[model samples]
Target: MILIINCGSSSLKYQLYTPDLAQVVASGMIAKIGEPEGYIDHFVGHRGEHHRCPVPNHRAAFALMMEYLQSPEYHVIECPRAITAIGHRAVHGGSVFFGSVLVDDAVMKALHECASYAPLHNPCNIIGIEEAQRMFPGTPNVVVFDTAFHQTIPARAHMYALPYELTQEHGIRRYGFHGTSCRYVSQRAADLLNRPIESLSMVVCHLGNGVTMDAVKGGQSIDTSIGFGTFGGVPMGTRAGDFDPAIIFHLVKDRGMSLEEVEEICYKKSGLLGLSGLSNDMREVSEAAAKGNARCQLAVDVFVYHIRKTIGAYAAAMGGLDALVFTAGIGENSAEIRAKVCEGLGFLGVEIDPRANEIARKGHPNISAISARAATLVVPTDEEKMIAIDTVQLTMAQPGAASVQMGHAPSTHGVAAS
Candidate 1:
């Protein structure tokens, strides 16, 4: 079996798959760690069980996960030895890891050094790996980085216009995120179209809470919306994306506001929340807009405008667009937003069937109109399956490794739309 672990600051989400990645054996989550009361929700097949307890930390959570997987009540696995390999979702690998890697002493050292890049996430990921090493001894652990797929971006796109010496000294350059999602969605789009990924020039819009627009050309990322930081992409739930830096200087220097306060406003008090003066969720904003709320309408318009603008820019960058992929929360579910984004892209030969768009989540994911030149697809991303695939491939390359049959595409059994 291959186990995939994704650790947040106070929670862990895990999935277990057979070595071949054809089926998901089990999946669950441990939430509210380090709190007085924590929750564990585990599932085997269609049945689920929930528990409430005082889970002190991630270590305790992992122990409970093991118990649930091996106990007579739910014997998803016989023992720790049943797991052939482990895969972890690491948020930021900085510039050190260009792709998924098998864990080792040197890799651990580098992971620690890169912790400065994502102080809120990488440390938790490191802890998860360390605990897995102690609990599942001798089992190879593979790390699939969220930023790895964008490492193919060239220097011209990744570099900032700042001073060469300053940027080089500080390692300040664009490292686009949501790479794992883009990689999966891009490949899945090709599969759905029955075409080779190498012949496709596509733009993948990952419009979740944290948004990223990736320009994938010939199976490699040429450029992306996100820059040196996560908040530099399209405006997200609470992030103020692509804002003027001069505003920051004016706030701190002229308005006498502290840098910390300005930073908080930029990261936590902006985006849909700031623009709509309501909920950060797109569903709620759309509802309010439908009810004739001016601010909410403005928020929706701004969001759609940015998405459409980015698509046009990427099409120009790639010479022409062959496919436009929509994945993640808002991208997959919101038909209105999809229509609005494609409304102005007629020049690019982009068109969508309204009936197909409405039924996208009902198993008809391709919404492109018959007259359109570019294909538009709503491909649900499977990051965990991607991680599991990487784990199986890396572990199977080892000497004396057991051979396992592999599947051609990722299974969508346990994955939800978001």
Candidate 2:
């Protein structure tokens, strides 16, 4: 099995996958670390259990989780050593790693250097890697970056309209997030459309709590929405997506708010929660909008308007759109939101069939009319499977791989998911 780990500043999320990368062995998440009592939810096959765990840090959480992995009652692996490889979901690989790589002394150093780009995410990821290496000893470990997929975005699209020297010196350019999900969905979209991914022009809308629109050309990312940080692009759960530098200055000078305070506003107090004067959850906002709540309606309106504007702009940028994809939380569940965004896009040959969209949930495919020129699809992302595929391929390419393969059964082995 190749274990997949995605750690945040205070949470560690993990999945244990059979080496074939086709089926999950187990999955769980631990949250509120560094406290006397945290929470851990573990699932093996179809059964799961939740517990209030006193997880002190990533290391403590790892130790506790390893116990469960070794337990007979719900064990996925007979022993911890049964895990041949560990794949870490590292954010901000910067320009150093274009693809997933085996973690080593040099690679660990590079991950640290890129930490400033994603301070909130990378530190926890690094901690997890260190702990896993110590706990798993000689098992092969790899890092798959969230920023790595967007590395295909060319200079003109990623460059900022600032002094060239300052930009080069500071590495201040667009480095989009949700790349893992974006990459997976674009490939899935191609499959649904029955076309070569390399022969298609498509746009992927990853509209979760954190939203980003990526324009993929010829199976590569040509452009994406989130820039430099997750703090920009389309409005999200709590982030102020698009911001002006002058607004920060004004908030500091006129409102007497500190830069840090302003940053908090940009990060936590804005978006749907701030605009609607309600919760950040889209379901809540949608419910209030249905009840004729004006601010709630405006919040939904702003979101739909951004999607429409982004789709139109990306189509122009990519020459034309052959397919449009919607994935993640809001995109997958909200048929109402999808209809509103696809409206008036008939100019782009996007004709949404209301009935089809309404019944489209739980991983439904096309939601557009059969006569529509552009194909519209809703694909659930499988990031862990992608990570497992990359891990197996990279590890198998190394020396002694045959011996490594012989150590595990066929069920523990996986086909490389390229």
**Candidate 2: C-alpha lDDT:** 0.84
Q: Which regions of candidate 2 deviate over 4 angstroms?
A: 398-418
Every model's Cα RMSD, please?
A: 6.5, 6.6
Computed on alpha carbons, the lDDT of every model, listed in order, comes to 0.88, 0.84
lDDT of candidate 1 over 218-286, digit per residue (tens):
999989998877788788888989988999999999999999999898888888988999978999999
List, residue by residue over 214-324, the lDDT tens digit for candidate 2: 999999988899998887988998998887889999999999999999989998988898889998899999999999999999999998898889999999988998998
lDDT of 2 at 359: 76
* Residue 213 displacement (Å), model 1: 0.3
- All candidates' TM-scores? 0.94, 0.94
Indicate the worst ten consecutive residues by lDDT in candidate 2. Answer: 409-418
